[model samples]
Target: MSQDLPTTSYALLGLLSFGDDLSGYELKQRADRTLRFYWVSPAMSQVYTELARLTKLGLVRAREDTTAPTRSTRRFQITAAGRRDLQRWLSSATVEFPALKHPIALRLLMGHLAGPETSVTLLEDYLGLLAERRAELQAVRDSLIVDPHSPVDRFRYPRMVADWGLDYYESERAMVVELIRRVAATDT
Candidate 1:
């Protein structure tokens, strides 16, 4: 990888380093299952495109599969240089401050144009969605708990990421509920 590769490139390298060679299709599936929730998840085309670039740069090795005469596919593994680059990127950190582009927050900012009733409804709907997301996270957590050998139990890092997401949803839920009450109070 070059010195100026985008984080998405590095994100793919990180996935490739995770201990198995994956075809472009499997990489996309794994990324959707894991990284899409917290980090950059490339689309299928992006995955194949990046794989091509990485192969050209010698950061990854791709082996062609000729099983089907009609279609040829490649499975990729991170090269030693790729692992080194990812390690260097990881060891040096420039923290990303969490930035939110929440539409409800945007609506609330201009809520005065419509009045507290509009803001209240917006908050209520947003709160419902947050609740639903929290429920889904809870389901994942419960599944992890039931299976003693789950990834979260064995890997401390995955648990930390999951905890941060769960906490974020919980905090947002509480904050929105408070905003709803405060907005409704003006009429009382």
Candidate 2:
């Protein structure tokens, strides 16, 4: 775990989680499937750039294709060195989540500058967004429960947690909609 391993290098480890060697395209697709919820996929250029750096650092090894006659399609595998580096990083690294700075909180803080109508409209808009998001999460929860192969669905406790989240969002959305209706009805 060289502290010098750039942030993008962790993503290469993520690609290896499937326990298969992958061309950069295959790696990118796998990363998209698993990491899209948390991390952005590196652009094709960024993937190549990271591969070059990781190879230079001895964290990943590449093999040239003799028959294909294209260098861009060369495949990579995690080196023994790379696996050791990854395990060391996992054991030694401290996890630090980025700061939480909610845009909605910022808007609420500055909202007095907006007149009552604007404030009400903003709240309504926010409610709409929340409802839409709740629906999306609901779909995710449903799919997880019904899709037998979903990783989360295999564990009973995590499935319960997902159900709880689905209920929580639906409850919150209803409460917010009701509160908005009450506020809009009240006269000064």
Candidate 3:
């Protein structure tokens, strides 16, 4: 229960606070499938490392699953203290804006170096990635809407954030499409 844990620590705590009793692998999957779209996605190693740190700090309870075939299998859940810390952090004002490390944005900025054709190719490739992510987000949102009693129903505020991400992605895609059209026209 440190006062100033990294945001990633709180992120993991927030995930654990969901009461799913997820293993590290499951946590990693949940993050990748849901949070990675908007928030910082930790590597597998970072997940495990943070789990250990949280365990040491008594913010999370990790139990070794002896019955499981895999050795050293651990499932973790947030402690009461962890929940309090997460709640406190959630209530706190924003410390900073989200960092943008968009490779596509950087490439687009330097598109002149590679010429319009290459920029067009990059945009197309980006479209493929964006489509995949958008579809995944939509499918999950649709499933949540269809099954109102699902575990995800608990995430009221998080859903709003997800809505924002969907909108952001769509807006980004539209802008890119326009950029590509402009570039293609100039190329011709």
Candidate 4:
């Protein structure tokens, strides 16, 4: 069953596994909050599309919520089948190496064409943007560490991943600083 569905479907299932009966909009918001750090957050339309697909596959169940007093909204939850498939995918799926598609690195590789000044400027700009992203991820990490002493904290793994991401950003920032120095030295 997992073979037929896109990874986004599984991602949504994982979101629902957190025990929240969420509308399509809520799912998208959750994705934006967390997935945007390491994965592509699906667009709102894509969220609805995947939800509908999952529902049709019996992996998700949806019911109309007329309690809004304005209009009805469909709230979705994962079914037993969804949990089984998610666990199967988690345990048995082949893990592939991460693909690096850094636009800054690509541009830096063609630095001779853009000249040293442009290259240095680009790396400098990236440093500021990197800091901004690090701060955002830091906030998320801070939120997750509310009960650090608890071994059974639900967000333990996510907090660890966020820490890993923060470390990666710091490493990348150091490398970019070194590259800027090299580029500036070349300009002399």
Give the top-scoring candidate (TM-score).
Answer: 4
Candidate 1, residues 62-106: lDDT per residue as tens digits? 988788789988889999998988888888857678555678888
lDDT: which is higher, 2 or 4? 4
Candidate 3 lDDT (Cα, 0 to 1): 0.85
TM-score for model 3? Answer: 0.89
TM-score of 2: 0.58
TM-score of 4: 0.92
Ranking of candidates on TM-score, top first:
4, 3, 1, 2
| Model 2: residues with Cα > 4 Å off, grouped in runs | 1-3, 65-72, 114-188
By summed lDDT, the worst window of 10 consecutive residues in model 4 runs over: 1-10
Question: How would you encode candidate 2's per-residue C-alpha lDDT over 1-188 as one tens digit per residue?
Answer: 45557657876774664367778887887665444334566787888788888888787888775666564457888888788888787787789784455565467566567645665677688788877766765555555454566664353543575567667667867876775675566536
What TM-score would every model get versus the actual structure? 0.80, 0.58, 0.89, 0.92
lDDT of 4 by residue, 1-188 (tens): 54656777888898898778999999999998887788788999999999998898888999999899799999999999989988988897778687677888899899989999999999999999999999999998988865666667788788889999999999999999898998999989
The CA-based lDDT of model 4 is what? 0.89
After TM-score superposition, what is the CA distance of residue 54 in candidate 1 from its true location, in Å?
A: 1.9
**lDDT winner, 3 or 4:** 4
Candidate 1 wrong stretches, greater than 4 Å: 66-71, 139-154
